[model samples]
Target: MSMNKEGRPTAAGAVTAIRTAALLPDEPLLFEIGDREHSGVDLPEVEIGEDRLGGFGRRTSLDLAGLTEPEAMRHYVRLSRLNMSIDAGMYPLGSCTMKHNPRLNERMARLPGFADVHPLQPVSTVQGALAVMQQLSDWLMTLTNTAAVALSPKAGAHGELLGMMAIKAAQEARGEGHRRVVLVPESAHGTNPATAAFLGYSVRSIDARADGTVDVEAVKAALGPDVAGIMLTNPNTCGLFEPQVIEIADAVHAAGGFFYCDGANFNAIMGVVRPGDLGIDAMHINLHKTFSTPHGGGGPGAGPVVLSEALAPFAPLPFLRRNGDGLELVEHVEGEALGRITAFHGQMGMYVRALTYMLSHGGDGLAQAAKDAVLNANYIKARLEGTFSAPFGGQPCMHEVLFDDSFLEGTGVTTLDFAKALIDEGFHPMTMYFPLVVHGAMLIEPTESESLQTLDRFCDVMLELASAARAGDAERFTAAPHAAPRRRLDETRAARQPVLKWEEAEGRAEAAE
Candidate 1:
């Protein structure tokens, strides 16, 4: 509410408010703010002549721009201030697991030896770095209860490729290369099918039951002698653990097929359940997610894969081995090993950070973290299940809660509008319209990093927004994000004709130089 200079409160969704950002106001692009002729350093002018430039001689003045030291620094600082990070507030993105990155891990990752050591440095001088990798591998193997771990793959997708490659190699070595089909559940990550197809294997989709889980009978029906394996996410995208995962794995093995599990949701049951115990042949553990390394923004990811005894011999090369009281990096492919995945062993900084996180929180602490994560998600579900529509009833979730837009069917407010309106209340919207199994899906994961007070505030705002939508406040939902720097955009037009460059975004007034 605002006064109109008459000492009277205005109405809700009125035009009395202004759409200006409190921070980073009027921040322009580098081209818009820089001068075409200014510079921070003196440069000798180049002479332009036909002898020097030949057919590439200049026809028009080049619009090369420059900025002073202070201007360049402040421009980036302003843009950095506009970003929304997990450190700033609650980040409820579900399947991605955007949680807090501990500062202590950062401090350890920046230590002199760990930060400055080269991948090709002398093995004797960099024994500590190699030791870090070995220790991380040991922890991963112990937690997942697998026979071996390959730490060279870069990220989750890369690790999937490694796991699938191992499965393929194991089948070929035993003369079962005729298997060509890979079964992938719809609830699994999209990368699961892509990785299988990239490896020249046929992808077959498996159906999910009404409770948002895979049925063991469905897996049994899909299995055959030509089937290679099954790629499944245990705690699926619907935020419910696949109750028949063990049975599915056993059935797949009965048909001479491998089991590859996508470990993206290992954050939900890291210390509580082991994938190997469920008859999984190969699984990739996302160090960036479950182990608390840097995630998002093109950050480095370490996805070390754990292998069962059946597939351990086909693990990737560049593994560490003990050679009479000294550690040796086995770079050569010996008998049946898969070739190297990368030029080096793995991401060193990511290994350091993940190990630091593990050491800081012992076994009990990690188990508690998993429990608290599930607890927080269930708490949010219990609070919002009545206001919103949960596709899967009121059952307890793993580490996230999934909701659909059934509550706003006749209210004229869509799931997108509700998400956009959430921006007005100072919170990042939950992951929306995902998993593709439910209509207008909204998945929220409040990692154990959040406090009860923060959860209450988020829930209160959510309830208030639900109430507003139910009351037919169409204007509020339609024209939302009133407090952000920019207004709602023409999403369809933007996607069809994207402005990739600054000049293109501003309707370029200057011609090509």
Candidate 2:
């Protein structure tokens, strides 16, 4: 048995040997495993009344397949085992904070009163639910030092649009309808520009300085009467905080414009700094990221936008307010308000999970969590600095570390290749080629959930990979992810010509035949 760099048997080598010994079975599709004749259950047919159907009833038998109970269970169980979740191991995705989801939060959300209540239920009947939402709103407003919050936005991008709409409404109320441009930093989240453009504002890009933070001088140059506002990400996509944020916000306000802070990276500053104090007019707080709700997979997310006193009155409709006896929802557009955004109140299940996280962490614990997240990221950066090249070196990052692929030069290992190799190391790859400002960016956010021992193991694997690349072992990087269920794919082609549905694939196969 050949020894690894640590003079011990490598787990990768062992895994390869196991694969060679007994190849794992490929997980077939659900349709492939399903049988036409198999039925896990038998139910007596019930005749539908004409009054119940109202002439819309189907006459033909439904086309449905069946599987045994054991088969159904096994199919899903195997699929679940293939997924890489926060519960499984460390998720180092930057910008997208994939921190551990506490079981306590899950338990609290599963409570019958919170989970089973319908949106159309009477306010009097669901008084406890309304109280929970109101308390959560109070916590958000208090933490951000903002005047009011619109909790109807569904996700981060959705929240961005909501805040912008409020800003636009406030501006129009002041007769500043000529403001039609939005300033976005080059390092802002991808959704910032999209959200602004979606709201009919022309987006202008603001350049970042060499240190990876937005320059106040650049903001000054972009300021004009036509400027609507600026969408900025603090502790930005580069993982560095914009020290000149206050000056930027002030300049925008002076230019007869508003400020929209993208709260995607709020996980790093919650309980540390409030955006309102930095002159922010409106900012969205991503409950999924900062408050530790289930994130990604087109999630049930909550991104409540906290507005300053200047913009609070223009908040979206369908907001909660205190009545004489209990809570009340304002569903219609009132004095200078933007209209409702959603059919119902925002994601209730996500709100419950987020509130549980906040209450469990409290004030001091939440602050400590932010500190720990920054510490963990800096630890990773310090460990791998000599082996990798950080775009913005010699600066203390807020929560995540940003690296460029300069060290991988002449190694024949592209960013995609290196990322794929990480699968063999039993870790999910960090966000790659993002922020778009740096060349081949690798953004890693090892949230506070991971312990030092786990961090060290991850670092060790990364170092080994870097060393192999430097020593001219091209195959180690190029022919990567040897142990993954799937091999390297032509990502470029997949993006350009995607088969969006199974029927599309069938059509292509028929054409090929």
Candidate 3:
């Protein structure tokens, strides 16, 4: 073994250092692990009668391969160790709110009553599940001080579409269908503008002031008879709260336009501030982020949209109702509701988890979680302020901290390079080049779940990396993660021309020959 300057073992004479050596040999693809003749299990052959056979019957052998029970178990366990998750270490992805998912929530979601109940079951059979949905809805509405909630949108972006559709429906009801423009702040979530455009509304860009919050005057100037509404994210993407939110909301309402608040950042102000009281007509709460459900990785997530009385009348249907008999779904748009958004009720498992989180914490506990999240973010900002450049320096951030790469100028190290280097330090990288308002953006959201010990360790690693960059040690960042299973990839080519499907190595070898 050869040691580098840091006394870490190096692979051969390469300048790069390997952090941790793999315990097992390099894992092969599943297809490569098993033979075509192998079968993992014994099964009885099925005999198809000519009368029962159809054109779908296979005439040739299938392409499936099999592994033994032990081999299959080991294969997955090794692959899992190669991936990063919230369980492995701290996930500091900003704006996405990749917080810890409580085991208690998972335990409750796995209960047979909650997990086994199908959406197509009889109403009376799944009364408990229906009650859970109603309870979750009530909790969300109470937290936001809104009149009603539609617990059917699949995720945050889906919830935005639902809210915008409600706004459009209300406008058309009042014969304002010509209000075709929606004002979105440049600092708003990327989904805000996409949702507006998807709803056939022209999106007008509202500029953010130097402080990273939307300017009230810019919003007023954009409001007109043709303006449908404004989609604003409170505690906006810069990790700073919109100070002029009330003024902007009042202006939009005064101009006969609704307010669609993107509730993606509700984790920072769950009990601290209510959007409804701020004159917001509609908002969507991401259960995965605010409440403690598993998020991302093709999630089974939920984004319930809470509506004000002005917009509640136009909310989507298939909502829960309490008749004289028991809790039942109003499967039709009986009253002033717009049509249904999803075919079935929303994600029941996510609903159970969110409600479990709420009941376990209660109102006061939820408020403290919000406070702690803000405190954690501010703690990070205070520690890394001098080493990194903060775009909005004077104010306290809500639940995340935003840093620009101005400090890295002339260091010959880019933001992407720095992020990749963090992987070699045995930690996941903070979100980079996001929220687009600032140049070379690096956003870090340390949710309230992390302890001081973990945070300090993470901060120390970041400071060390910063010092290396300033000292002109470009190799440390440029050739990073030599310990990982693979090395840096050509990101531009990967994004522009992705090979979505798997191709066998043997086919490639034959083609080359």
Candidate 4:
């Protein structure tokens, strides 16, 4: 076998490893597999061949990637071995809570009641699903201390947009439609300003104090009659709680603008702090992050937005409601609604899994879960302080710890290089070059699910990497992930001139073949 220039493995020569390879044969497309005289399965002859359309087009030839069923199965099994998942081991991607997706949650999601329900089913037929929504809603309301929940926004970014839309709607309703500027912190998630911009509002950057919290003075100066609101990530991206969150919210409210909280970091303060209580007008809870549902790689995710009383009336529709005898879904009719973000009640499977997780861990358990999450992050920070450079000197971190690349000053290793090395150690790299306020930011979020032993092992690897960097072995960091299926990539070139599809490279492959 050979590897592409980008280091993607090729299956040109060697067979893919699979236990039952003897039962399977590799695919040889179209002309090699199908014959005019042979068939794999026989079908009863039709009395009349139906023509769905006048013959504007008809198949002249069949082009298929042909393989026997067993071949296909084996091929997939071999491919699965090359992948890494949360099930494999610890995934320390900060901001992204790639924690365990317990089998119990999967089991409940697969139950026929939820798995088999159709969107067009009558209201009476799906009472159980509606009840689940209501139950989830109750938990969200109690957890965030919000007046209403909009269970339609699809993911974290989508939820951010939804919350902003509600804020916009409430503002417009109050004759403040000219409020067109949004203040986003320098350390906020990238999605915060993107959400505002998508809704046609001008985005203004807010500054962070030396302590890593949003500067209340900077926010105050940014507020005016034309300002719509502020998109703040409390337990801000640096993984430090915004001690001035209430004062910031009050500033926004005093300036006649709604406060929109980016609740992506809700995993850190889930049970401990309520966005509503902090005077947030609206916020979105990432179900995958806070409730422990699996996300990333183009997800099966849910980001339900929680609304304060002012914005609740303007929330998007297709929400669940219970009547006297039957459960009814309150969907906006045609020509209604500010907008319909997603169709037909969002992702039901994610809803089931998130609610299952919430139920298994009751309110108090969820609270303790958040506490443990903060504790784990602090543990990492405390243990690695001597080895790495933590930007915000010495305060207890929230759900994640942020370190700058300054510690590697004379070491000659960049954050990217260090992260690539982690892959070689059979561990996923922490989030790097994010929360742009920090130079070469390395954010590590060890969700509460990890045990102390696991944390210690991760710390050991990190310490070793730091020591190696200090030892001036720049080569070690540059060419990393050697033990994994792939190695370090030219990420800059990959991003700039991406080979988006395999078809684009097929001509070169065909020439070689």
Winner on TM-score between 1 and 3 is 3
Candidate 2 to native Cα RMSD, angstroms: 8.5
Which candidate should be chosen as best, given TM-score against the real structure?
Answer: 3
- Over 259-345, each residue of candidate 3 has an lDDT whose tens digit, in order, gives 999999999998889888898999999999989899765258799999999988888888889978689998876565478889898
Q: Model 1: per-residue lDDT, tens digit, 1-513?
A: 222333333322212121236555556666665545544444456885547665687797566545555556777777767777787788898887877899998899899999999988888888898889999998898889999999988999999999999999999999999999999998999899999999999999998889899999999999999999999998999999999888998999999999999999998998899888998898998888888887866369888999999998999888899878778898886474578899888899999998998889987888889999999999999999999899999578999999999999999998899999988887888999988889999999888889999999999999999999999898899999787666787899999999786664343344221
Expressed as tens digits, the lDDT of each residue in 331-384 for candidate 4 is: 765644365678788888888888999889888888899999889999999999
lDDT of each: 0.86, 0.85, 0.86, 0.82
Best by lDDT: 3
Candidate 2 per-residue lDDT over residues 1-513, each given as its tens digit: 222333442222111111222434455555455433433454445885555676697896443435545556776777677677888888898888888889898899889999899999988888888888898998898888899998889988899999999899888989998899999999999999999999899999998899999999999999999999999999799998899999999999888889899888888988999888998888888888889898875258889999999998888878787899999876866464667788889899888898899899998888899999999999999999999999899988889999999999998888878888888888989999998999999999999989999999989988998988888988977888888777777789999999775453574354345
Better of 2 and 3 by TM-score: 3
Q: In model 2, which regions exceed 4 Å deviation? A: 1-25, 35-65, 68-70, 297-299, 333-336, 504-513
Please list the residue runs of candidate 1 whose C-alpha ends up more than 4 Å from where it truly belongs after superposition: 1-21, 35-40, 44-65, 335-337, 502-513
Better of 1 and 3 by lDDT: 3
The residue pairs in collision within model 4 are none
Which pairs in model 2 have colliding backbones? Answer: none
Estimate the overall C-alpha local distance difference test score of candidate 1. Answer: 0.86
Residue 513 local lDDT, model 3: 50
Q: Which ranges of candidate 3 are over 4 A from the true structure?
A: 1-21, 35-51, 68-71, 297-299, 335-337, 505-513
Poorest stretch of ten by lDDT in candidate 3: 9-18
